[model samples]
Target: LTIVCIVGGGPAGFYTAQHLVKTRPDVQVDIYERLPVPFGLVRFGVAPDHPEVKNVMNTFTQTAQHARCSFHGNVSVGKDVTVQELQEAYHAVVLSYGAEGNRTLGVPGEDLAGVHSAKDFVGWYNGLPTNRDLRPDLRCETAVILGQGNVALDVARILLSPVDILKNTDITQPALDTLAESSVRRVLIVGRRGPLQLACTIKELREMVNLPGTRPEMEASDFECIAKMLKVLPRPRKRLTELLLKVAVETPEETELERRNSAKRAWGFRFFRSPVEILPSDDLTRAAGIRLAVNRLEGEGEDVWAVTTGEVEDVECGLVISSIGYKSLPIDPAVPFDPRKHIIPNTMGRVQKCAGLYCSGWVKRGPTGVIATTMNDSFDTARTLLHDMDEGTLDISTVKPGSAGVTTILEKRGVKPVLFSDWEKIDSEESKRGEGRGKPREKLLDVGEMLKVAWT
Candidate 1:
């Protein structure tokens, strides 16, 4: 029998464990999560209104309940236990800790008030303990978001979404209250490249267009260059580009005028712009605006790059949210990591020069893709591990203790790990709390509160 220790309880870890338990019944898998709760990003990163996307949690729940699988929450790998310790107790260790760090803008005035990373904003609204106190001042009317990804769209949607619509979702009460008092009326999503290179998908874009009381503010010139290439591009890109063109240029003048007159809020895309600095208010205490360098695209398709056009412009805004990207952090000194690419050194999920060690998901590949992408990547890693076991590349002859061994070590360190049942208790309590308010769940926003509930 082989004992496998996965250092995350997110989609990657759950998917890998699912495959292992189904294929190799002889294998016992244990998932260790730093948070008291399971379902890392699915619970904390996904927007509260998008309940359909979170339906995957049902499948993950099944994986966690498997007899051969066990979940140990509130277990920090580097702090609570080391990678070497897991290796000594298990036949293999799979590092699937998804990216927790956010890439910074590295510009002036980033430290100013009203400037925040979209990661923290998402976490703040989603009830992440660390961002519970992120009381973003939404008194300003104009807000600027840097990036053109789904996360950027999500932030925009949440900012512009009707309060009544968001009230019934799982959004934290504190965020709900803050947004209710928001005075923001316009959101400008800026991207370095043109509309053809937008990183967001059609679903997210459609949501923005259909948002109640909101109208799209797009410049016709941004779609002129991409008109001819729409039909020639791939199906998804072609559809997305066509949608943008229709929304930006093809709308009837009468209907467009009516929308402009009637809409209470608006969102728009700004292309060919890169942030040079976040301009500070006169008092230097808050973000007042941003300085952007005009950019022009070179080449075509995925090979395109943004080049500065030697012209700069400043747009006045009170809040700035950077949704550029998520970055993976190096786990411990014992594991191999590439600082340049921000990924673990691996070949097809196998850690380089290290036997019985593997990685998958965002840690194995740079942070990108959706849940489906992570699922495929994690399954591949599990298959590779099983292959090695059969081929004798991984030695499973030593009958090592699995969760029991790790539990003893954690107990010795005075760490009370939250078991799978304990997480279910937390889940039930959250659901019960939300039931009274007509929401899916009212998440606990403090670590101490979460542990208290879990242990009880």
Candidate 2:
């Protein structure tokens, strides 16, 4: 029987496996994941509080349990195993490894101790093994968060969420303690433009504004800015406009101020300014303040917001969280990646030049949509693959399951592949350890912990 070796265990990988095995019962499928456990970003990327969104994992697990499917954990391309070997051994190789990196907000003071990327912060709270100890040092009077996306909103809500309310969740050790001692009294959410243009869903914004510690408040000028934009903003095809209208009509100025004040009383923010540069707080420190680029509404009426010019000013903030956005990472040399788009170059699901290679999910398309979108993408790829199989055009070389030759080749090449059992033990240990802490499972962050949990 032909063995289809799938790489990654996220929504795309397992979905594809589910499709491939269901269609062709005679075929054998092996899913290889770099993590000791499965479910890539879903296990670590989505916010922990939204347990409903994470229910996708249940379906993924069910798919993995198919008789024709097997899982091999802790194996990676380039370091743990070579892409060329899988090409030679398996009938087909599918790369569903979603974007593994976050887009950096390349700004000054970004490398400082108190600054954190939203990606790291989200992972720390969501139990990504690589960020179990990741914590935001919130022991500051003021905190500034840049960007206005859903992820940005997530960071904002999490920063303001009650520490006691989060005790039962699978929060990282450092994050838990930091929240318990968080000295952050005021949080400033800065945007380059007004809130109308903020790239966040209304639901996410509400989650932030209505968090337990504080309802978020808006400055009168901030509301004015939003109201003014609403009167003249164009109706675009994007859903953002729909949400904009909903906010403008449903929430007027009187209630807006009340809600804003409520949020302010709870957790306040300063809006409508841009950050020019981050300045140091003292004469002898890395950075203790931010040099804000002041702005003014330039155009009058329709033209009023058309131009904005600013003088420079400095603002003091103890910590900064850059919540820019998420980017789909380009595939490494191990896979055929489109550098310009950061996607795996493929025709349908098939890799363009490489025979017997396929791609699905974010690597194939750009990063987008909910978990359901990923599943549909995988199902499409699987259909294309099945077509090739029926025509006998799929040329798979002879290879045995867990064979001696394969093991020798991996060892000789210094590729330490993580097998299925390793992941089970890692899973067991994490769950068992979590019982004492009254959490779901304690994550293993960083490369060292991952190795110890999976291999040692």
How many pairs collide in each candidate, listed in order? 0, 14
- Which lDDT values do the candidates have, in the order given? 0.93, 0.70
Write down the lDDT that model 2 would get.
Answer: 0.70
Write one digit per residue (lDDT tens) for candidate 2, span 269-378.
44456776666656535456776665565535333342236566666777787776656664347677777777888899898888778899988887766688899999
Model 2: runs farther than 4 Å from truth? 132-135, 220-274, 283-286, 292-313, 328-334, 397-406, 413-422, 445-456
List runs of model 1 lying over 4 Å from the truth.
Answer: 253-260
Q: What is the TM-score of each candidate against the true structure?
A: 0.98, 0.83
Per-residue accuracy of model 1 over 204-232 as CA lDDT, tens digit each: 99999888889989888888868998767
Model 1: colliding residue pairs: none
lDDT of 1 at 226: 83
Among these predictions, the greatest TM-score belongs to 1
